[model samples]
Target: MPQSYVKRILNARIYDLAVETPLEDMPLISDRTKNNVIIKREDLQPVFSFKVRGAYNCLLQLTDEQRKGGVIAASAGNHAQGLALSAKHLGVNATIVMPRTTPMIKVEAVKRRGAKVVLHGDTYDEASEHAHSLVEEKGMTYIPPYDHPDVIAGQGTVAMELLRQHSGPIDAVFIPVGGGGLCAGMAAYIKYVRPEVKVYAVEPEDAACLKLAMDRKRRAVLPQVGIFADGVAVAQIGKETYRVLKDTIDGVITCSADEMCAAIKDIFEDTRSIAEPAGALSLAGLKKYVAENGVEGQTLVTINSGANTNFDRLRYISEQTEIGEQREAIFAVTIPEEPGSYKKFCSLLGKRSITEFNYRYADNRDAHIFVGMQILPGGNDRQEIVEKLQKHGYDVVDMTDNDIAKLHIRHMVGGHAPQVENEIVYRFEFPERPGALLQFLTKLAGRWNISMFHYRNHGSAYGRVLVGMQVPSKERKQLEALLSELNYGYSDETDNPAYQYFLS
Candidate 1:
């Protein structure tokens, strides 16, 4: 036996996948990396993900009779869609078992591809177990999501594309690991073709099964997986993928929900395409690795493997971006419960925009009044800001340093102020672009006088604004009710404590 039969099978699997999928050199992202950073755009493949490569390769190795019986697969989302679509194209019946918690959008996508969709348990592992049982009961081919050699070899096609697309030797390749099929396959191929190149496997912190497995020198299982990055929320690394990957990978890393969100935002801004959180894991890992290890001057490649995402997930991503990047600060200010107190507090604010204002008359306390403000991001002097407020006899609670603000208030926020009889509080979700604020003000015109206004522009698609306008009592009802017609929301906050503090 010159070479083992298993080794030959792995080689053949990789060969088959390379012929079917196209590779693209992502140039815009390359310039930023400064090391001829190329992307294996597995996201652009036939199923809009690299999963098809592995699923199809695995199917091709299946016997014709088994193919006729059809295939069953369990996926967080993408793999189900991939296997179902590929199986349909190959004229094989596909039954996809997905978690009940799986987004309707992904379920519809699988159904649209002509696959039988079965909503099973609450998590992928449960759905996968159900599919495995079906394999024995129905004599259908059970397509392992990431553990089989065929699947790994199919995933290796991304490495082949990168090697062909880029001119120089790759210093490192970053791959996102859910069950580690993609990373294992990519690492195996890279090791075989270019052994010197570093292979990095990235996983979400909540689902770092592969990294934990590597550290323990064995497959590690997580009690529960994180659903934030639903695409890679594997509670256990696949056994076969682990065997292929254990020694080939250089290191394993973890990323937070925020880091993933920031990476998704970066990739979107760079390419105008939204990547699923798992797809952005490679980039997130690269950034974390580079910053931590101080690694530089090496050509890097990250596999942007999938783009299927729930549009609603973008809201969570946007909410986490600022905290992950440390670009926004939230604070609570205690001003005097007296006349001209609001004016003094405003004067203390130097070149800062208010993103939030939560003030309530907790008690008839004269010494303190609670107010929350989200300061503009970057280069903030927390001490100076606090000192200035204190100089004006206002106590400052830097909620930026408070856990409550970090966890709750930062995300569940809208501009809030006290309600006034003649004043109306309107919430405007304007585009987060320069001059957008001015356009909103211009739209208001001379009909309403600005009593109080608050706006802060985070790097979000839309900015939230709370404007307090003093309108005649006759016009107040009409003004408050007219915003809905203009596509904005108005709440009569005249009775709100925060509003009364600033208004009266």
Candidate 2:
């Protein structure tokens, strides 16, 4: 065994963890990124996290007298459950103080593991303060989430496992940061054993307490944390953990909610495991850091710390995956107003699947249309579509993979303008492909303009389109003739009630 392995043996007796987690090389994800990426599946640990290793190790180190006195802990979720289970195994009384805003599932989980639960305050800081007061008032042992030498030693066991199970030297290790327990422990241990390996800490951009602290060269506190990634939504890093992290960790990076979601999906596709946003932070960090630094061909290991994620959040994850990866595109297009103009426009999208479609032809102004579509997975032909639309003088605003488009524009703004007149509505089935829409736009002729349109690709074989056109009623015959030539399905909603409100 190596020195790192020997250290684990000396310290193994201190932890109460029932099982050691495995480090498995993820071939699917490795191939996707064109690098050797291995995952330390801490999510599969007995506690569904490496938290048990530290929580139990800290408790076991206490003298018999301290055990008799009992113990207290503060956490938003995972640590609470870890301590609760550990105290139960040790036959010691444990009380967990959680913020009142903690999710019901987490609160129940802590209690289910046989710990007395006390809900206090709205944030973790307030709850931690209350826990401290209890410790002083009742003389109970306080088991902190991190910020202790013993905790760091115990959490370091994760690195112990990685070195033992992995065959190759790790180029980089990405770890998620909260109170900085995991990063601090892993960094200290890795540096002590393998001085050449690099350690990186990742945090949610909205709640990047560690990143902020590293930049300021002091402990920094955030006023609010985004609860989306609940596990790592900590406002401040622990003092002792920060001491180890400030110098031991090579760098700190922040990831956006969207990027994290995409990472989660990618990991799920590869490992068939659902990682919480916090758990996905390490993978997201690796992607961002690698891209920024142009790192390539490096063996990487990212800790999948915990997966205690809510299932409801998966819906949003699925919906935004394309948007997160920039595979979906949204556009605003303008066409000449005329009766058959809508059909001619649909011909432009050759094979792109439409995810959403809406149109209004009641009111009129300049023919401005909004459209959204999910391009085929891994498709990168956006410029080709733009060129086709530009050739026919169709002005388009591309919003694919744009945060502003997904969060705001995709569902907002469409239909006929009340200020304009002679608008008509038509819905068409267009092929969902990169240049399909552009070709239709190129073939369209005349002075008639497009008033409103909505189209989004859903990664399907066919596309559904909604378009509003402004043109003379006499041009209706010509538009029908063009539709007949296109040989695709069509629906005319020129008189629909929705057309009236949006167009009027």
Global Cα lDDT for candidate 1 = 0.69
Off by over 4 Å in 2: 1-18, 332-346, 360-362, 366-370, 375-504
The residue-by-residue lDDT of candidate 1 on 260-284, one tens digit each, is 8778876777677788888888988
- What tens-digit string does per-residue lDDT give for candidate 2 at 26-67? 787687677888888888876687788788888878999999
Worst 10 residues of 1 by lDDT: 1-10
TM of each candidate vs. truth: 0.72, 0.75
How many clashes does each candidate structure show, in the order listed?
11, 41
Q: Return the top candidate by lDDT.
A: 2
- What is the number of residue pairs that collide in model 2? 41
